[model samples]
Target: MTLIVTSSGRPCAFSEVVEKLAARRGEKLCLGEVVEAFGDRAFGPVMFFFALINMMPWPPGGTTLTGAPLLLLSMELAWGRDELWVPRWTERASVRRSTFRKLIGRFQRGLKLTERLSRPRLHFLTGSFGQGLIGIACVFLSIVLVLPVWGGNLLPAVAVGFFSLGVMQRDGLAVIAGWLLTAATVAVLFLAWRIIVASVSHGFDWIGRIA
Candidate 1:
């Protein structure tokens, strides 16, 4: 499989690769045909791409909407004049396979709306809806990232990005993990927000008395 980065510099639709992996849904990407097709050495880069996209900020109006800048950033990081690969194991195959399956189910559910649109353009077009959501997600994440929130809002962005790539590549396992992570992140943020609000209110009351 060709893994060249797009002009925007992000790895091309991981969807295709993911799809191939999905066929082996009962097993791990490392266990069977996926390794044969993508090769054992390529696993590092593939997982790296998945994690990077998984953790990235979402595009505003769908992929095309806010994905351009992300693509550029990815390009700079992956293929810039000084580009280099940094390997990090995001998860094990056993865990990731289950996570990815769950994520794909969610993506499939959302696709119901697009399916009704009936316009091929509207359905596959990732620029508007995908990017818009991602953009909004990024802003939310930016706020959460600065706060003490665990996982932060970035998880959702990562989930969406992974979903996008996974949909394109048909990688259900990655998608599952993305969604799980996103959900966990959001939960953490909700808890943190409550804590911060309570602390701020307590602090204000303590500082107001002149006596």
Candidate 2:
């Protein structure tokens, strides 16, 4: 039901493949193959791509992302600007354009921050709340994807891919497994950050002593 049809109004899976491939390869692979080979589960791939896009860096002192082009970029990246048949959930269930705003609304319900986070949370972590959680990750990812930041898309992309695929296939164990993977990933990132900071601080201190 949440599956979006293509602009051409046919069942598309470009997005779905994007989600899956990103889970495994991030942006390293060829976009065209991903878009064309997605076969049936396009939403996943599209959502994954957006998740990565959402992490871009905008101007200084700005955390919000841009719009318009983000949607177009997603479409292009997922379906290729060529004549590829991209699938989108029909307009009946489609939620484009204001996707970021809608997600913030969902996250805000029980959350103190903006509600956008709620879409994915409700879709994957909790059902029966609003629309399916699949959109949560997709919309959130799309928000970050529109930004200008670097490396910002990785975590969210992976998270959304895992969550979306898990929910779509009804793989509850996979959901829990994803949580574990996420925790491990976070721990690794934190440790790496600490090491980098320590190394830099040590280097600066040594330089100062020598000077």
Q: Highest TM-score among the candidates is held by which one? A: 2
Candidate maximizing lDDT: 2
lDDT for each candidate structure? 0.41, 0.42
Q: RMSD in angstroms, candidate 1? A: 11.6
Per-model TM values vs. the true structure:
0.34, 0.39
Task: Give a tens-digit lDDT track for model 2, residues 1-211.
Answer: 1344433355434333333344553323433433444433454434434433343333431323333223443344333232334334221222232433344344334322211222233333434321143343334444644454455445644555454445444444434544664565557567877998999999999999999
Runs of candidate 1 exceeding 4 Å displacement: 4-68, 71-161, 209-211
Which regions of candidate 2 fall more than 4 Å away from where they truly are? 1-45, 49-156
Estimate the Cα RMSD of every predicted model relative to the unseen true structure: 11.6, 14.4
Clashes of 1: 35
lDDT of 1 at 133: 41
Candidate 2's TM-score reads 0.39
lDDT of candidate 1 at residue 37, scale 0 to 100: 42
Candidate 1 local Cα displacement, residue 211, angstroms = 4.2
For candidate 1, the per-residue lDDT at 18 reads 52
